[model samples]
Target chain A: MTEPLATGSTIGILGGGQLGRMLSVAAARLGFRTHIFEPGANPPAGDVAHAVTTAPYEDEAALRAFANACDVVTFEFENVPTAALDLIEAQVAIRPGREALRISQDRLTEKKFLESLGLQVAPFADVPDMDAMTAAVEQIGAPAILKTRRFGYDGKGQARLHKAEDAQTAFADMNGAPAILEGFVDFSHEVSVIAARSPAGDVACFDPGENVHRDGILHTTTVPARLNTSQRMDAVLMAGKILNSLDYVGVLGVELFVTSEGLVVNEIAPRVHNSGHWTQNGCTVDQFEQHIRAIVGWPLGDGSRHTDVVMENLIGADMDRVPEYANDKDVALHLYGKTETKPGRKMGHINRIVR
Target chain B: MTEPLATGSTIGILGGGQLGRMLSVAAARLGFRTHIFEPGANPPAGDVAHAVTTAPYEDEAALRAFANACDVVTFEFENVPTAALDLIEAQVAIRPGREALRISQDRLTEKKFLESLGLQVAPFADVPDMDAMTAAVEQIGAPAILKTRRFGYDGKGQARLHKAEDAQTAFADMNGAPAILEGFVDFSHEVSVIAARSPAGDVACFDPGENVHRDGILHTTTVPARLNTSQRMDAVLMAGKILNSLDYVGVLGVELFVTSEGLVVNEIAPRVHNSGHWTQNGCTVDQFEQHIRAIVGWPLGDGSRHTDVVMENLIGADMDRVPEYANDKDVALHLYGKTETKPGRKMGHINRIVR
Candidate 1:
């Protein structure tokens, strides 16, 4: 077998948002260099990385240069343009390969993939056209959500059809973009399982985190999620099944709906997830470091929890409450260093570790 | 009050060693830019910093350019030439001011300063010449250690004169460099208290870590040291007295000897220290971040421990055990991206957090 990249090797990151920023920090801790390829004038990750490429993703020459400079390329977000991945994959290795991204990009395909693996997922129907939209409404009923098959996040590009009029108008508002209509599941609470798998097929999973949402965004995640041993094990099993199916080489965050019947898979994030922030304080190796290890072909760390932890997100105006947490004996405050605190923005987080 | 430096403000560091490397990573988490200024070609800190200046310490033009670019300045080592500090101090703000450095640079002055603050210190006297050395030996005894007042570290520039025949020869070997004769305290153990003080006079101290030295170099530090509550309290109080007296604005590491009678201050490091490595995995905020907060004028964080921790240094050839650690559970490994590892060099450290 080829020798694994040494600690001083460079890791190329496709995006330079907060997730990339955090991952870059993790790579540096392991004595790995990070080179950021981002289109933005200023990327948070670039502020600390060894090198940065500011050209657009369409700049194939710059993409080649970035790939040539790195040992392996990994992305922060899965919605990265397919062409961008193909360019880097041709020039260098890309972890959590393109197949995983293609499946996760489309809502219908992701749901179907879960079904194929014998996992219970929320019932979803494809809306091919206006007629399909009407048929889906009839089949799924009111109070269901219609979402675009691709490029949607943070409550964007999705509509809740609570009434008959809402269905047709909402469908037209989407301008007939290919979409999926999901029937609402009666979930008592939402939880997520963060699992990592190394190239050698070694798998490690963190304790499931019970998540609370605000305005369709995660607000807090409490570890040792209020679930029985069986339920927790079920959540982790679903994540491992997904990772193995995808041949995943990094951390995957699997969101689940805890229904009266059993656990139902909601979605899979190919990288670190907001709900897994509790791992930063509760677990031995956090999701950030685990992601680094997986991408760098290193052994996966123990993802077990030593302390019960509650992670509260500092959204927008809530950032002002950071000072109150500073003096709280159990609280660990983390500010994201964002310049503006617009409404609905993630400003920071505070994790409290309970012994 | 003046406005706190903004998130994007640049912090110029005076040394590019491992401490500066870790400090750069910490500053990046807060969205502050870091510029490492050192007189080396490829320092470890350069791997992650926004910018680096490779020029001799006496290069005034380069020093001016670096100071002009940064909003604030801090040093990773006390051995930074006073001329460099003078150049930067004239152009920008320097935290943990010059007086703190002057006191810490000399063992004699540091001991005197510690004793003046009503803190327990090992008996020490200055040996200015052969006559003074004879008198010092008569008073402090033959088993004492004679150390250069300046530029001594990792057991360098110091000699243990165990026999009367070794005293004059060891004293003459110092070449008349100012020296301090310290009466060795036959202590049960060595420990350290890492503390931070904000400009607002707020102080926060991490729990004392019991330390063990191999060949006068720190090999391991265990947190929640085997000390009573009163002993822990005394350690914190002594650190507080030193910081408040110096009006220190960053993290300081105070090494102590736990004697049968009480705690005696061994040495004071006016910067982030090796003994505080456990804080990276044990406490909510690591010592590097604590130093950044104090220097940037932010309030101190909760210094509470989350888990009992053991930090083991990977000195020189011990880095070969990295793969062993990578496969271990619950250990956070950090390796400096240094190109070479000579004997007695600090390559990195691993922190294991145990419940």
Candidate 2:
């Protein structure tokens, strides 16, 4: 096993959004400093990070300097350019490694990997061209989603089809980008398990949290997700299977569909996930800290929940309720330090503990 | 009476110690930025603060720029030079105000102010010179402590007198600095209340925590202090009384001695105190955030703790056990990111919640 990052050593983070901002704070809690690499000027993580390299992913010189300055590197988002990671990896080790990123970066690759592990996944077909799209639509049938294989998030780059006749229009929306057609599952609700793994191969998982989405954005995640003893075990066990398969290091967010037949995988995130925010109030070790620990090679923290929590996101217009929610004694608010409040933008979140 | 700080407003902090570091993190949680003004190089707070001014307090140009950049100013240390505060106050408002500083900067003044409010404090006499020392010795008697009137911390600038004959030597130790001689209070243990107040006259107080000192520095603080329901009420009432009397904005730490007869006010810190570290893990709103909320004109947060916590300071040698303590899943460690560990220096702390 490698030595954990020394106290006061710099850990370079590849993204500077809310997840990176929180990871910086958690790194500080453990006596480590974080350096952020992002293209955007005045990124939210810049406010807390020890240093920031404001250059696009194509800036090899800047990436090299940032990598050289850090003892180890980690990314808050899985979609970071592979070429940038190649440069950083040559200078410093990147936790959660290249394989995890390579698989999760594309929907087709991720689905195939999960299926290879004997895990249940939605019926999916790759669509590289119009001919492939026609074949995929025939296999997946109607009530399916056509999503860009790369860079898809927050319900973006997606087109839903009601029948085979709509496949041509949905494929046209892809703009010639590689795509994946996935059959919709008749699941009751979605729940997610936030799991962590250390380089030493220790695994820890937080309890599943039930998720609700509105306007294609996460609205709330309530703990004590409607799962029975066996389903909870199934969710955790499946998450562990994925982490172990990848030899993963750091936190992973695995969203799953709870169906009467069994649990089917929805998607996976290689870093701290929004669905895991409830851990901040419900458990001793939140997802942010757990990720930092795993990447630094520290022992995985106990993630047992001590209380029930409901995590509500304050997106754009929802920022208006900050004052009203701030008055509630049980609510713990965490804002991202974002300056603008655009519609559907995630501004902040509050974890209200159930007394 | 004044507008609350805007979401992206900058909050200037006057020190770059652990308190400032934690305060910076707290301010970010509320979508506010922080600029730390510290004279030292590579201050611990610099790692997380949005901006840093590394010039001495006497640098008028730097102080002006720092103040001009901030919406409001607050300090982590009470003994900041008066001239620096004078310059900053002209440009921006200072929370907790000058009156609190004036009283807390001098032990004699602090004691006199306590007496003025009908609060119980140890019997004390002032010593400005040899003649005054002799008079104070006669008045306060032996088995007393002689402490400098200003800038004394961590038991420095203090001398203990076993008897009246020892007063001459203790007086010599002061080097002509103004001092206060106080008879020791016969107390079983020490407890402190971490309280907060807003400009609108809103007030809130956390439960008192029992403190243990080692080598004249805080060692550990345990919640659910040995206070009966009445004593608990007295502690909260006294803390609120102090805040209301001063019209205080921001959090204050008040230490009291638990004696059989009654509770005695030991002293008060105008800023966050080391004894209140337990609040980080035990309460929804920690003291750092509460201080920010108070200074920003936001409603006072709920300071009520949800569970029992034992906060132990990680001093110089105590850091040797970081890995050991880290292995314990029950301990939530918070390090200050300090590169060096000197004897009696605070490196970090941990809050162990009782299951």
Candidate 3:
């Protein structure tokens, strides 16, 4: 049996973005120290973490020192280089395991894995070359999205096909990388479930949050999504099924599409997702604490939402509204502490308790 | 007009205990970095703060460096040496000001100030010497407590005089320091109001929390204290009166005695108090965040409690029950990350949402 990490143990975080910043704060609340590993200088997490290593993932010496310092390791982002994980895994345990990361890292692999578990997912076909792309487009039809199998996020590395004749142009947009064509689902709304599984096999799921996207970026997430009681239950059960199937530990974000037929699995994030940011104020124990608890081999915390919350993401110029929000008694502002605010960059978010 | 501190500014905190640790976390949440100045090595606050300086308060060089590094300076404890503040204040702003510190540091001065504000206080007399002690005891009568004028906390540096004849022994316990003879009030229970005053002269007070002590240390603080409507209003009004009179620009904790006559002022802490820890989970804006906002010249947050909370301190050996608390969904455990546990030492606290 794995022993729970004692208080004062250092938790090594693989990325130092806003997720790592919030995770570091949560770890400190539970009496744990956090050490952030990020290749970029002046990471947001560096401002709050106990220690920060500004070294690339390929630096074996730095990775060794960080892994040796921590009792256990976890990543804030799923795209942590596999070589770095292989090196850190030899020294300390990595939560959600390498299998969870591998399956979720690629679009083709994630869809196939979800399908293998008898879960409903969008129809998809691999596009290995120009010939394959043409054949897949003929099968999936128009208005489908063609996305690179790896490292695609937030409308990047993806293209849309309006007709069968547009296949060649969309394939060229892939930049010669492997791609997948997914059929579009005529859904009423999008929702995501933030779930966790403990090392002891205990599962806890937060209420699904209805997501709204603007320019392919998450704009806001509102709790008590437009879901019936049966749909909510089904989403949670399906999330638990995914966690148990992967033998996963720590938090995972599962995006779903709500349709007349049923809930369809969109994708999964092995680490904490932006959609779960509402838990920070709406629940007693938030997603960050639940992630820390699971990775440290502790029992999962209560993920039940006690209040309805509307979380609005502050992207780029949205930070200008901070002073106004700060004066609003109902708004709980969380800034990422990023010095530079470029357009499309997620600067912060505010979780307002509606009820 | 004093400008509000911008995001990414450093907040310098003196005394690296649990209070400083929690304050650091709050500052981080608001996009501010914290630099902890502590006399001891390996302080609990150091685990979460961006930087730490382990130097004695008398170290002028270190104090100057810390002051230079921060945009503003504040302390978690009131007993910060005057010399250290003198050096730091010249370089940066110190919230709650020197007058508040001077008044609250001594029991005699604090009581006198409260009485001057037309607030009811326990009958007291200054005992400067052995001769004065005898005279004061005769005037104050029996069943009174003789406490040191300064540096007295948690029932320390005090002695009870049952009769006038017990004066000599009680005075001896003062260790030649200045003392105060305070007449005991016939009170039903003790409650405290955690209030904040912004630089703009706005004052906000949280609901008074009923306090229960064990062996001179705070055991638990429950919100919605046992008080009638009149008593609650009187407690809050008195707390506001003190803050406005002091021209305070930070959080202040006021302990009151609920009596038939009215609420009697016991003492005031110029910094956040243990009794106010319940605000972390019970309210959207906690005492720590309120203190930060006021000190930074920002408007105060909502001090209203959304849920009832009972905060229980984990003193010394009580740390053994952390595993049990971790498993309980209702308990929000906060450990101080102190390696050693001595008898009566506060190791951590749990804010339980009772409702």
Compose the digit string of candidate 1's lDDT tens values, residues A237-321: 8899999988899999999999889999999988888888888777778899999999888899988887789999888888677
Listed in order, the DockQ scores are 0.61, 0.84, 0.76
Task: Give the winner by lDDT: 1 or 3.
Answer: 3
- Tell me how candidate 2 scores on lDDT: 0.92
Residue B327's lDDT within candidate 2 is 86
Which residue ranges in model 1 land beyond 4 Å of their true spot? A1-3, B1-6
DockQ comparison, 1 vs 3, better candidate: 3
Candidate 2 deviant stretches above 4 angstroms:
none
- Please list the residue runs of candidate 3 whose C-alpha ends up more than 4 Å from where it truly belongs after superposition: none
For B103-130, candidate 1 gives per-residue lDDT tens digits of: 9998988888888888888888898898
lDDT at residue A127 of model 3 (Cα atoms) = 97
* Residue A277 displacement (Å), model 3: 0.7
